[model samples]
Target: MKINEFIQKYRTVTKLVPGLTSSHTPHVICNDGFEMSVQAGQSLYSEPRDVADSYEEAEVGFPSAEESLLTPYAEDEENLCG
Candidate 1:
């Protein structure tokens, strides 16, 4: 979704929280407990989409726990000998 559209939809519902520094961006906590920062003089987009993209990237880059456990390493023999 476009940044303007996202801001328009949530602007009314979001409340501004105290910023840590002079240039610190304003943050809003959504009804669902999601928090996001709004950049000054710029449109802000949906954070959920960004989070989803990160998860998708992680899923592709990392192996499953079961697969990792099934794999053997040369270090295993070295550790056993010690």
Candidate 2:
């Protein structure tokens, strides 16, 4: 789907980065959950289409479950020393 169409469908923020050879593909950041990068060769005026397995991917690599569970407690201990 096109960039604008994707924006309309998802109603998210889209960013376009200009590259030396060509403008980079548009990427959308969703308000509710995740970020999506529009497929290459797609244009803003093309037909609206859903990206395959689009919602399954995550842009940022988050900490593992164990790390995440302990991070807050570790921070709290450091804060208490101040």
Candidate 3:
């Protein structure tokens, strides 16, 4: 599915889950019963690995150091220099 479509779907499903907080990532139960971690403001566009019986079973993975530093959301050189 497209990223925007995925984001919309995620928002819909998450509303049904209870006790989700905005301060941290939420563990979402997909329609397929596989659980995945969804960052508060981001969407999961791909199938996540490490599915289990519950959302708590889903593991959160972090990007590599290089990826973290170079992400499109990261501050650019111009912003950093200012």
Candidate 4:
């Protein structure tokens, strides 16, 4: 279906990327717990969409599952440390 039509059919759960690419060719999760991306010159979407399985599939990989960032100093990865 067309991107506009898809928007009309489903409520957006969350936008995948916050960067510039998100504005033009957005990859989004819909309220029904499925994922879809803009296609065909930002006009249409492919059919047979799938339920969002993991954040990794969407490139929304988060660092830690912990609720808080306040972790022991030793737990910090060297690359993440100054």
Candidate 5:
């Protein structure tokens, strides 16, 4: 799924299970109550070798090193007005 679509879906699912926070990177609350992060290009059967898939696709449209890091600068601030 696209990044925007993934964010929307994740927002809805997280409500049922609290302690879930997904900002720039997608994450989910695991069955054991721990958190799991979903990297780009990940599917239901994601593997360690899948890292490059998203990077390749993204390059065709907007080639940049930005996507290499998930969280943007603004999102790094823990306090809004600090």
Candidate 6:
């Protein structure tokens, strides 16, 4: 997936080290929920890993880092709501 697509899903892209991030190449999000921009190469290719289980974005809903981080607790969320 492209970086834009990845941003659409995982909104908050937590950088490992902003200072180390480079401008060249494409940036992608890994399955582990981290955005790789620094020293990213063609080998990394272009596939944005989807991290959210059932997380959905509303028409105007802007997902926050905290909200996206809570995706792991999605199962527990259903239990609570159920």
Structural similarity to truth (TM-score) of each candidate: 0.21, 0.23, 0.23, 0.22, 0.22, 0.19
Shift of residue 36 alpha carbon in model 2, Å: 0.9
Q: List the residue pairs that clash in candidate 1.
A: none
Worst 10 residues of 1 by lDDT: 53-62
Candidate 1 runs further than 4 Å off? 1-25, 42-82
Error of 2 at 34 (Å): 1.4
Candidate 6 global CA lDDT score: 0.35
lDDT of 6 by residue, 1-82 (tens): 6444544454543434643321232344457675434222222222222222222331111122234444564545443222
After aligning candidate 6 to the native by TM-score, how far in Å is the CA of 5 from where it should be? 0.3
Candidates 1 and 6 compared: the better one by TM-score is 1
Tens-place lDDT digits, model 1, residues 1-82? 4444444454442324443212222344445654445432212232333222121111011122223432352234334222
Q: For model 3, how does the per-residue alpha-carbon lDDT over 1-82 read when each residue is reduced to its tens digit?
A: 5333443455433332454322234345455654434442313222332121123222233322233333454345334212
Candidate 1, position 15, lDDT: 25
The better candidate by lDDT, 2 or 4, is 2
Ranking by lDDT: 2, 6, 3, 5, 4, 1
- Clashing residue pairs for model 5: none
Error of 2 at 63 (Å): 18
The lDDT per prediction is 0.31, 0.36, 0.35, 0.33, 0.34, 0.35
Relative to the unseen true structure, what is the Cα RMSD of model 1? 14.7
For 1-82, candidate 5 gives per-residue lDDT tens digits of 5543544465332222354322334464434554434444323222322333233222111212233243342343343222
Decoy 1 TM-score against native: 0.21
